[model samples]
Target: MAQDNSKSELKLTKYNNILHTKIYRIEINDYQIVELIALKNGEYDGYLINCIWKINKNQNRTKSITQKIKIQNLTVKKLMAELENGKFETIPDCQDLKGCIEGLDGTTISFYVYKENISRNYSYWEPESDYYYKDKIIPEILQIREILKSINHEFDLRTSFAEFRDNLPKGKYTYGMVIIEKK
Candidate 1:
């Protein structure tokens, strides 16, 4: 199985011992990453990670820091409802991804649904605007983003990362991955 949250080591989940469907979205660019994972039982995990390396003045090395917060069951029902409301199953593949050029800067949004017998993942390579405010799967994905962002906002995620993305130094960064690395 491919690592959903792009890291070499596995990050243990609260319900890793149980059976449950996992629904998630990762909104990321060069500067920062915002991700949210929701379970059917209302367990949600979120992260606000900075892609730019931190100074780490004392250690003499730069590092990435992930600010994680766990929110219980408040928004999962609403999020799952949005996905059920003719959104996830009906949403078509993205056109931009098929003809996307590599090496150009743009925000990539990926959504996933995983379970014992179900595995679905969709991604888009946008032209980089609006933080997906006007996404094709609006009302569905837009609301999803809102809920995810709200969870991430608890960790201080920004309304926009475009403002100072270039002002920081790049480091170990992975899009759509739940980073647990501290080195």
Candidate 2:
């Protein structure tokens, strides 16, 4: 009988834990730049900004990812602030948080948190919308997914290191994947 080589244990490093993942220090200034680019040419006009951020493996890596999110008829500032402050732990209903604002740094802002009971009437533009995960979260997952995929490896998206921040209706700092996995 052949031995169960697949069951053999591989050496794990201390950095494998979530606590070991690296976090970069970013400020409002860093976000101002991205907000400018995303808004240039009126690319995201009607869509209200939602979340922005990134993920990482540990503190030793350099380079990280950035994200920008916008949703139709959704709260801009409150949603952005909630996500920034780690509110909801997961994405909340579009109607649950509602308010209105002029803009952030010249960008228009609005509010529209969802009501869980109301239920959406339209089909999802993106299949993943069913999940609480945000678009900003997807790309970061893809970065790791692509890397692991290329190497014929598999990883758990849930376990992946991710961090995000946003400035709704305009300006936001939605990246920082540096420190989890390296390029």
Q: Which candidate ranks first by lDDT, i.e. highest?
A: 1
Error of 1 at 38 (Å): 5.4
- Model 2 ranges off by over 4 Å: 1-64, 77-178
- Candidate 2: tens digits of C-alpha lDDT, residues 1-183: 011221121111112122322111112212211111112222221221122323323332232233333333223232233333432223332234232111223221111122223212111112223233442344423332232232122222222223232122322222222112222
Summing lDDT over every window of 10 consecutive residues in candidate 1, give the lowest-scoring window: 1-10
Clashes found in each candidate (C-alpha, N, C closer than 3 A): 3, 24
In model 2, how large is the Cα lDDT of residue 64? Answer: 26
Model 1 per-residue lDDT at 177: 28
Query: TM-scores for all candidates?
Result: 0.50, 0.16
Between which residue pairs do clashes occur in model 1?
A: 5-177, 5-178, 6-177
